[model samples]
Target: MLQDHLLEEHAGPAAETEPALVLANAQVVTAADSFRGAVTLQAGKIAEVTDGGAIPSGAIDCQGELLLPGLVDLHTDHCERHAVPRPGVQWDPLEAAIAHDAQVAAAGITTVFDSLVVGLRDADQTRRDLLGQIMAAVEKGETLGLFRSQHFLHLRCEVTDPTLLDQVEPHMDHPLLRLVSIMEHTVGQRQFPDAEKYREILIKLFHVPPEQVDERFRRDAEASRTFAPTYRAAICRMAHARGIPVAAHDDETLEHVEEAAHLGMALSEFPTTLVAAEAARECGMATIMGAPNVVKGGSQTGNVSAVALVKAGLLDILASDYVPVSMLSATLRLTGDDIGLTLPQAVKMASLAPAKAAGLDDRGEIAVGKRADLLRVRLVEGHPVVRTVYAAGDRVA
Candidate 1:
C-alpha cells in the first residue's frame, strides 16, 4: 500500500528508499485529542502514535513542539501570485512554480490545490496565454519531484466566459486536474453583489478606466446571463464523470446554493453570503473559506465573514487562498484567543476536512496506517511558525 501511494518520481529525492523517521517527544495533536507522544514513520506510513511509549534511540527529538498533521490547502492562488507578481508582470512558469512550492512547503501545506485560471474572456488573453505553459510546468515539476509538497490542480472555470469548454478541452484527461469550480465574476452578481463596490474594485485592481467600467460591467453581466447556466451544467457533468470534485464559487443567494446542489456539487468555495453558506451546508455541500479572510478579519471584496461562518457551524474547510502562510496562522488563531474551538478542531479544519473535501483519504491525520505527512509547529510571540515538514515520512522542508 505504501509503495502504491508513494509520490511520483523523476530526478529528485524519492520517498521509496528514504529511511524511516521517528519524531519523538512532541505534543502530538490527533483527530480526537492532543497528548505528549511519539510518532513513528516507516514505509511511507505512520507506523505508530504512542503516549510515552519507548522511543527509538535514533528518533529525532522534537523537544515539546506542537506536532500536527500536515495541512491540506484546498484552494491557493499563491501559484498565480508567484506567476504574476505585479498586475502585468509575468514570471517564468517553472521558476514561479518552484518558488511557490518552496513557500507552500515552508508554510506547512503538505498538500495544495494550485488554483489556476481557466477562463475564456478575451479581456484577459494574457491569463489564457500563460495557462498551458504554467500547467505544463507544474506537471513537469511534480513528476520531477521538484516540489516539496504534493501538488494538484484546481481549475477555476469562468462559467460566464464564452469559450469556457474550449479552454479546458485538451486537458480533460489531465491527471492533476483533481477539482473544478464554477465561478462567475460578473460585476453585479455573487462575489460582486454590490455594483458600486464591484466597479471600484475593477477601477483599482484591474485598472479599468472609470468611464469604461459601467460598459464592461454591462457586457460581462450580459455574457453571464446568456452562458453561465449552460456552461455550469456541461462542465459540472464532465467533472463528475471524471471523478473530480466540483465546487460552486462565490455563492451569494439561496438560489445559487440550490442550483449547485441540483448539479451535485460536492463543495461550495468562498460563498459570499452567510445565507448562501447555510443553504449550501443544509444541502450537504461542504463550505470552504479562505484562511486569509479569517486572518484579515474580513474579505478584500467585502464579503461575509469566514470567522462568522465558523461560529455559525457552517464552515467545513479552510483554504490558503492568496496567502500561503495564512493557513497555519488562521488555524492557530482559530484555536487561540477564545475562538470557541479547541486546537484539534481547528487543525482538522485545515487538514482532514480539506483532505476529505478533495477525496484524499490516505493523509490529513496523524494516525497509524495513514501517510506520515506531518508538521512541527512552534509558537513564538503569539504566532505559529512551521519548523519542519514531512511528506510520506521524508523530511522535505
Candidate 2:
C-alpha cells in the first residue's frame, strides 16, 4: 500500500481566502473562438466572459493584448536543472523552488508538473535522497502561496532501474504527485535509435570520459534487459492504485503503444516515430511532443518532427520539456505554418490539451467557473512577448 504520511506532511494547511481579479479589453481565446472580450474573476475563478468595450468595475484594462489560457506544462525538468546546477553542485531546495517558479511564471506557464527522475543507475545515494527534499520544498511553497504557478510532481520512472519501484511507492500518495511517466533510457533504442548519437549525448550528460562510454553503455543495456518487466509491472500497479495518470515516454513501435494502452495509460509522451505516435492515437492516448522540437525544426534525438506529427493530426499536446519559453513561442510558430491549425488550435496543444491530459479540468480554457489562470501576450513583429501572468486570478508576474 502507498504511504499516507507523505500526503499528511505535504497537505500543510487549508487556504484562507480567494481573491478576485478581472481582466478587460483583451482578445480572449476560448475553445471556440478568439475575439475581443473581457473575463471577470471572482474568488480566483472566472465568473464571466463578455464582449470587449467599457471596463467593468474593478476590471484592469488589458490594452488589447492577446489573452490566452495560461500554459499547462505536463513535463518540464526546469526544476531539476535548478537542483543540480552543475554536475556536482547542488542548491538549497527552497531556493531552487523559488527560482524555478519565478522563471516558469514569467514564461506564462500557470500550471507545471515539475518532472523529476525516480531512478538513476550511477547517481550517488545523496543525490537520490535529494528528490524527497525537493518535493517537500515544492509542497511547502504551494502551501504558503509563495509560488507563481501551481506546482505538481511528475515522477519520470526509469523502468530499467530495479530500485525505482521502492523509491516511487513511498511518494505515490503525495498530494502534489499528479503524474508519472515510465521511461527507459537504455541506449540503442526508443528515443535513441542511433547508437552513435546516443553515446555522444550520454557522455556529455554524465560527464564521462569518452573512452569509457562504450563500456558504461554495455553495462546499462544489460541492466535494462534484466529489470524492464519487473519495473513496468510495479509502476503500473502503483499508479493505478493511486489513481494517478501514467504516461509512456519515447515509445518507438506499435507494440510499445499497445503495451501502454493495456496499462490504461492516457498519455504517450514523445513517441519517437510517426508509427508509434499514430498507434498511440489509435489507442486513444493523447500524443505529446516537445515544443523545442517544433521550434528547432526537428527532433534533437532524430525522431519524427513535432511539426510533421502536428500536420498529420497525431499530436495532441506540446510540452516545453527543457525550455519553458518554447511552449508559447512554438504555438505561435505553428499558427503561421501550414499545419492546418489556427491560433486557437495551436494554443490548445500548449494549454488545454495538457491540462486535460493531467486531469486538471478547471483552468485550461477561458470558460466560466474555471480557475482564472491567464496570460496576456502581444505579438510584436511576429514575436510573442508575455506581458502579464496570473494564477488563480492573482497576478504572479
Candidate 3:
C-alpha cells in the first residue's frame, strides 16, 4: 500500500508541485547491478529507474558519468578541524558545522556521522562544554534545511578520561546521537602502541613540547587506569538504554572484542589486529575500517592494515575516518586495478555497508522506497569528483 501510494503521489498532479529531477544517460550503481539507465527523482525519493531512455521534459543529461549512492561516512574527526580552525582558535559552532557539512557534501557524502571527541584530560572547561553547542548547531542546521547532508552525532568517548561520562550525560537523549564509540587512548596500546610515535604525533599535531608530551602521557595514563572501567560501564549502560549503537575503537585482541561485545557494542571501529577483527566477525559485530587505510596502503597509526583485513575476509564496512574524500577513493581502490569489482559491489563499502552498520535503513542505496540520497560522480584521472550531491531528493552541492 505504501509503495502504491508513493507511486500514485509521485505520478499524479503532485508532480506539478515537485520538479522531476530526471538523470539521463548515466551509469547507475544500483544494488543488483550497474546499468546505463535513466533515474527519475521526485519529492526526495527515487520515483523510477529504467533502462529505456525516456527523457523527461526537464531531464539533465549526465553524459555517461558514474552515478552511485551517496557515501555514508560512519566515522570522521573532520568536524574538529572546523571547530578548531587552528590550535586555540575556535569558530562559532554553527559556522563550523556548516563548513564541515559543505566539505562532506562536496566530497559526495550525503550522510555523515560526525565523530566528536568527548574526553580530554587537560581540556579546558569551555572546550568540554562545546559538545552541546556543536550538537545544537547540527540540529538547527538540519531543521533549517541549510546543510547538504544528513548529519548524525557519533560521540567518541575517551574511556580513560574520568569526566567523559559527565560530559555526555546531558546529551545522550538527543535523537541525532545515534552512535557511541568507546575509545581508550592510553599511551601503551590501541592507537599509540609505540610511545615514541605517540609523542611524535602529539608534537606534530598539538605542538606540545617534547618534555610536556611525556609528562602529559604519564598524567593521562594514571587517570586512565583509575577511571577507565567505571567510565566504560556507565557509558555502555547509557548507550544501551538509549538504543544507541555502541562501537569499540581500535580493539587489539580477542579479549578486547569479547569484552566490548559482552557490553552490548555491536560494531568494532578500526580494530588493531586480525584476532580482534576475526573475533568481531565471530561475535556477529560489524567491523569498520578507515578508507584512508585502504588508499594509503596501511594504517597511519601502525596498526593492522585495512587491506590485509579485507584480504582475510574480516573487513565489513569502510569509514572515511579523517578524510571525507577518501570514501569513494577507497571504494575504487578496493575494487583492484586489473579485475575490479562491479560498481554495485564497489559502492557498497561507502554506502550500504556503513549505513547498515550504523543502523540507518532509510538511505544508502538507490531504490524506489529508500531516501533519494544520491551522488553524481565522474572519474577524472582515476580520482572520483563530485559532480552533484543530493540528500532526500534535494540538491545540496
Candidate 4:
C-alpha cells in the first residue's frame, strides 16, 4: 500500500530544543523566485527564509533537494474514486478517507479540496449513497487529526437534476464546504459536444451499462433542458448567500462563460476550448486546468490541452482532478522546454494560485508568518519524487 511505502522513510532530524525547525541546504522555490536557501519554522508557521549555502547547527540537511510550498488542490475527485474503487466495490467511508489522505500527502499536497459529486439521479446508487458517508467521515477525520492532509469539501453539483438545490442546501453552510461548482454533462453541449464521444464515456469511462446508455443520455438531456436554468440559479444563490466561491465546470461557449461570470463564479474549471478560456479572462475569472491534462499532454475527454492554455496565458490554477500524483508531475512538466515556465512560476499554479482562488491566504508560499506547509522533493531518474511532507510545521508524511 502507498501508506506503508511513505511511512518507511525517515521523518527528519532529531528533535531540537530551540522551538524552531530548520531545513537547510535546499533548493527552495518561493512564490517569486528559486534559490539555494534555508527555511525556519516555529509555532506552526514559517519563521524565516535565508538565501545562501549556510547550514545552521542542528538543522535538517535537505541534500540539495527541492523545497516547495505544499500544494493546495481546489478540485480533486480522488476521494470519490477511493470510496468506489471499482464498479461494484465500495470501501468503508472512514477507511477510504484515510487512504485518500495518505495518497494526497505522499503526492506533496497538504491542503486538499475533495470533490464530491451530488445530484446525479441516474448514476450508480452505491456512489450516491456514499456521498454523505464520505463527507461525514472526512469531517470526523479532520476534527480528530486522524489524517496527514487537511481536507475540505468541493461540491460538484449537477444542475440538470431538479433536486440539486435541496441536495446542496444543507452543506452550503458547512464549515468545510469551501467550493461549489455547477456543471451539466448534457450530450451535444459543452464537454460532450459529440454524441459518439459521450456514448463512449458513459459506457467505457463511467462504467454505465451499454444497453442503458441511450436512455440515460436522453433523460439527462431532457433534464438539462428543463431544469438547468432554475437549478443552477438556485444553487448559485444559495452558495453566494454564505460567501462560498462557486466555479463553472467544462465551459465551452462564450455565452456559458458570460453566464457563469454573471453568476459571480470565482473560477472556470476545465474550459473546453481556447475561446472559452479567453472569455473567462475577459470576465475576470481565473481558469483552472487539470494536472492530468498537462501530464498526459491532453484532456482525457478530448477537450483542450493544458499546455495550450499555458501558451495562451489562460491557465491560472492546476487541479489534480482524479490523479493526485499528477499535481507535482504537472508542476515540473510546466517548467519544461515545451511550456517554458520557471520553477517558481510553475509551482504557483498548483500552490499559491489555488490557495488564493479558494480564499485561503495563509499557507501557499515560503514566506514569514505563513503556515509552514512544505514539501521536500527530489528527482529520481528524471521524475520528481516527494521525499517528505510537512503540514503546519509538523512532519505528517
Candidate 5:
C-alpha cells in the first residue's frame, strides 16, 4: 500500500470566492494561433477570448504585451539544489520546497514536475538522504497551499543503482508521482559517449579527486552492466502498471529509441544525438530537450544541438531541466528568426505539448474552459520578462 500520510491526490485550494479577471490589449498565444486579443478569466478558467483590439470595460490593459499560457515544465532539478543549497548545508525541507516554488512561479511556470533522483551511485550522501524528505515536503506544501505553482513528482530512476527498485517502490503510488524515467548514466554510454568529458564533468560535480575518477567510473560501469537491464525492465513495469507515464532518459542511439518504444515509453528526454531524436519521433515518442540547451546555444556535454533538432522539426517539448527561468526564455528564443518557430508554436511546446504529454488536460492553454494559468510577459531589450502570473484564476506572482 502507498503511504497515505505522504500523498494527497491533487489537493488544490478549496472552494472560495474567485473574482473574474480580464487582460486586454495583449498578444494571446494559444495552442494553434497567436492573435491580438483579450482573455477573460472567471471561476478559475478562461471564460472568453476576444480577438483584435476589443477592450471590455473594467479590463486590465496589458499594453500590447504577450499574454501566454503559463509554462508546464515536465522536469526540473531546481528544487533539489534548494534542498541542499551548498556542499554540506541542508535547509529545512518545507522551506526548500517553498523557495523553489517561488522561483519557478516567478519564471512563469504554472505547472512543474519536480525531478527527484530515486537512486544515486556517487558519494553525494546529502542528496541520497534528502530524497524522501523532499518528497514529503512537496506533499506538505501542496496540502498547505504553500506552493505558487502546481507541483508533481518525476522520479528519475538511476538504473545502475542496485537499490533503485527498492527506492522507487515506495513512491509508486504517490499522488503527485506523475512521471518515471529510466536512466543509465554509467560512463562512455548514453549522455557520456566521451568518457574523458564525463570524467571531467563528474569531477567538478562531485568534487572528487582526479586520480580516483577512473576507478570510480570502472566500478559504476560494471554496476550498470550488472543491474541496468533488469532494473530498467522492472521499473518500467511498475510505472506502467500504475498508469504513470514513463520517459526514456538521454537516449543516444537508434537502438535505444527502439527499446524505449518497445517498453511503451511516452517521452524521449534529452536524446543525445540527432539520430536518436529522429528515431524517437519515428517511433511516435515525443522528444523533450533541455531549455537551457537552447538558451546556451548547445548541449554542455557536446551532444546533439537542441536548435539543430528544432530546425529539423524533431523536437516536441522543452523542459526547464536545471533552470526554472529557461522555460519562457527558450520558448521566446525559439521564435527568433534563426529558429523560425512562430510565437504560438513555441508557446505550445512549453505549455500544451508538455501538459498533454503528462496527462494534464485541464490547463496549458488560454482557451475557454481551461484552467486560467496565464502569464503576462513583456520583451525588454529582447529579453522576455514576466510581469504578472495567474494560476487557477489567482494571482501567484
Candidate 6:
C-alpha cells in the first residue's frame, strides 16, 4: 500500500480555474498540417481549430509565432537533478517536485514522466532512500493539483542490481506508475563500450580516486554481467504482466534490438547506433532519442548522432532527457532544410508520437476534444523561446 502520510506531508495547492483561451495569428502545427490559424480552448479541451482566420473576436494575438501541441516527454531525469541538486545535498521532496515542474513547464513540457531510478548505485543507497519520498511527493503534488504539467512515474529499472525485483515489487500496483524501462548501465556495454571513457565519466560523477576506478569497474562489470540477463528478463515479464509497456534502454547493436523486440518491448529508448534504431523501427518498436543530443549536435557518450537517424527517417520520437527545453528546439531543428521535416512533422515527434508511444491518447495534439495543452513559441535570435504555455486550458507560464 502507498504511504498516505508521506503524501499528506507533501500535498500543496488545488487546481486553478481555467479560462477560455484563443490563440491567434500563429502558424498552428497539427499532426496533419501547418496553417495560418487560431486554436480555441474551452472547458480544458481544444474547442476549435480554425484555418486562416481569427478565433471569435477576443482572440489573443500570437505575433505570428509557431503554435504547437504540448510536448509529452516519456523520459526525463530533470526531477532527479532537483532531488540531489549537488553532491551530498538532498532537497526536500515536495520542494524538488515543485521546482522541477516549474522548470519543465517554462520549457513548454505540458506532460512529463518523471523517470525515477528503481535501484541505487551507492553504498549508502541514496536513490533507494529517497525514491519513496520523492515518488510520493510527485503523486500527491499532482493529485493535489500542485503541478502545472501533468506528471506520472516512469521507473528506470536497473537490470544489473541484484535487488532490482525487491526494490520494484512495492511499486507494481502504484497508480502513478505508467511506464518502465529495463536498463543495464554497467559500462563497456550498451551505452559505454569504451572502458577508459567510462572510467573518466564515473570519476566525475562519484568524485572518486583514479586508483579505485579500474578495480571498481572490473568488479562492478562482473557483478552486472552475472545479474543483468536474468534480471532483464524478469523485469520485462513483471512489467508485461501488469499491462505496463517496457522500453529497451541504450540499444547499441542490431542484436540488441532484435533481442528487445523478441521480449515484446514496445519502445526503444536511445538506440546508440543507426543500425540499432533502424532495426528497432523495422521490428515495430518506436525509436526514441534524447532531444538534447539533437539540439546539442551529438551524444556526450560519443554514441550515434540523432540527426543522422532523423535524416534517415529512422527516428520516431524525441525525449527531453535532461533538458526539457531541448524538445522544442530539437523539433524545430529538424525542420531546417538539411533535415527536411516540415514544422508539423517535427512537432509530431515531440508531441503526438511520444504520447502515442506511452499509451496516452487524450492529449498531445490540437485536435478537437483533446486536452487543451499547447505551446506558443517564437524564434528569438534563432533560439526557440516559449512565449506561453497552456495545460488543459489553464495558462501556467
| Global lDDT of each candidate | 0.87, 0.87, 0.84, 0.89, 0.89, 0.86
Error of 5 at 28 (Å): 0.8
lDDT of 6 by residue, 161-203 (tens): 7788898988877877879998888767889889888888889
Q: What lDDT, from 0 to 1, does candidate 4 have?
A: 0.89
User: RMSDs, each prediction?
Assistant: 2.6, 3.2, 3.9, 5.0, 2.4, 3.7
Taking the tens digit of each residue's C-alpha lDDT, what string does model 3 give over 1-397? 3323432332224343687789988888887788888888887778888875455667988888888888899899998779888878889999999999999999999889889999876789888778788888887786666787878789999877777777889888876788999999878887788999999998998788887987889887898789887888789999899788899999998888888988989999999988889999999999999999988999998899998887788887889898898988988888786435667876887898888887777678898767788889888988887899877777889
lDDT of 3 at 350: 84
Q: Compose the digit string of candidate 1's lDDT tens values, residues 133-177.
A: 888888888767788988888999998788889988777677788
Structure candidate 1, residue pairs in collision: none
lDDT of 2 at 240: 90
For residue 39, model 6's alpha carbon misses the true position, in angstroms, by 0.9
For each candidate in turn, the TM-score is: 0.94, 0.93, 0.92, 0.94, 0.95, 0.93
For candidate 5, lDDT tens digit of each residue in 1-397? 2323322223224354656678999999888888899999887778888898777789999999999998999999999899878877889989999999999999999999999988887646666778989999998888777888989899999998888887889888887898999899878889999989988887898787899998888888899889988988898899899889999999998999998999889899999999999999999999999999999999999999899999999999999999999989999999999889998889999999999999888888999978889999999999999999998878899
Evaluated at residue 365, the lDDT of candidate 5 is: 90
Say which candidate scores most in TM-score: 5
Error in Å for residue 135 of model 3: 1.4
Q: Which ten residues in a row have the lowest lDDT in candidate 1?
A: 2-11
| Model 2: lDDT of residue 50 | 90
lDDT minimum window of 10 residues, candidate 5: 3-12
**Residue-by-residue lDDT tens digits, candidate 2, 1-397:** 2224432322222243544467888988987799988998766777789986667787888888899998999999999999999989999998999999999999999889999999987788999999999999998887776787888899999987778888888988888888999999888789887888988887887777899888888887887889987788779889899789999999999998998999888899999999999999899999999999988999987899999998888989999999999999999999884666887899999888898888877768889977778899998998899999877777889
lDDT comparing candidate 2 with the true structure: 0.87
Segments of candidate 3 deviating more than 4 angstroms? 1-17, 52-57, 338-340
Report the lDDT of model 1 for residue 229: 94
Candidate 4: list runs displaced more than 4 Å: 1-18, 124-126
